[model samples]
Target: MSTSPPPLTLEADAVTRITRWVAVGALLALIALCLAWELWLAPTGRRTLVIKVLPLLLPLAGLLKHRLYTYRWVSLLVWLYCAEGLVRATSEPAPGATLAMIEIALCLVLFAACAVQVRWRLQRAKAAAALG
Candidate 1:
């Protein structure tokens, strides 16, 4: 009486896999950038600024596991870093501004990867549910 939807194609699977890796790579790069900027390349007034990288570490395990919920939340979470990047890129002098621009680029990449993965997964799920 009922029919199932077509399974996701090899291309769809590959796209999701690529997005996952991109998200993880961008996150790691962002963490390293933050640490370098705050600790070595351009130390801020307060050494405590290095703590900013800590929050970025929280998502690694979830991302590595490809948790959909994690992707959704991380998309939202990345905005905070983007905001900081915007503020610093405009206000800070040369070295700090350069690091902030790098942070912004990484944040944009991470957000895009998370958003695309979440959207594609949700669409796949919805199509499967509707057909089955």
Candidate 2:
């Protein structure tokens, strides 16, 4: 007879659900901020900079679906925005610098949400396995 490991159930408790919503909200805010900053609030010489928002769009579907892999990868992905925000906040002036600061804040929130959701989910799964 062949033996197989039990299937893992990914359930969202209240905290996990809240974290997921927070992640989604932060992500949407980041996307909107990127668009407004590049196109309206402070446009660079080349509008091409707006392309930076593309990668942010990639995680939307996965996030909405609450995929664990998406949360894991997005936690790593948010750092790039943080770096960009840090660089711009230091180099740019006035509204651009302010916008960068906002970006940094949103990135931090998003990262925190992803990290919390992933940790909680994994812990829950481990506990379930133990009990099962």
Candidate 3:
């Protein structure tokens, strides 16, 4: 007798899970860095603080919940951070440039994690669908 596969959930593999958490952690770190860099460390001395921190909040819930769809879209959202970082890192002075470098690194981490997680989860889902 043949058996069918069980229903699939958003569940992922160990590597995918680790990657997702890494993305979430990197995103949180990036947000904190942006806050401190603008509001305290460098203090652009403008009302830019809210602008820097607000966009980050949009993805927090999805990332916290480990939603694959979030991983997919947030990966795209990260390029804005990367572009900002590249500009500041190349043109700004010391500490600001340094913080920009950190932002770039965090963005890269988040992007990589999101990509790997999405790929792994999609593959697993496709395989499961085939099995059933």
Candidate that scores best on lDDT: 1
Q: What is the lDDT of residue 58 in candidate 3?
A: 90
Compose the digit string of candidate 1's lDDT tens values, residues 24-119: 999999999998889899998877899999999999999999999999999999999999999999999999999999999999999999999999
* Candidate 2 per-residue lDDT over residues 1-132, each given as its tens digit: 424434444555677889999999999999999999999999998878999999999999999998999999999999999999999999999999999999999999999999999998898778667666
Report per-prediction Cα RMSD to one decimal: 1.2, 4.1, 2.7
Where does candidate 2 stray beyond 4 Å? 1-12
**lDDT measured at residue 113 in model 3 versus the true structure, 0 to 100:** 91
lDDT of 1 at 12: 88
Local accuracy of candidate 3 as per-residue lDDT tens digits, 1-132: 445765445555568678978998999999999988988788775848547778888999998897888989999999999999999999999898999999999999999999998998788878778887
- Candidate 1, poorest ten consecutive residues by summed lDDT: 1-10
Alpha-carbon local distance difference test for all models: 0.94, 0.93, 0.86
TM-score of each: 0.96, 0.91, 0.89
Which residue pairs show backbone clashes in model 2? none
Q: Global lDDT for candidate 2?
A: 0.93
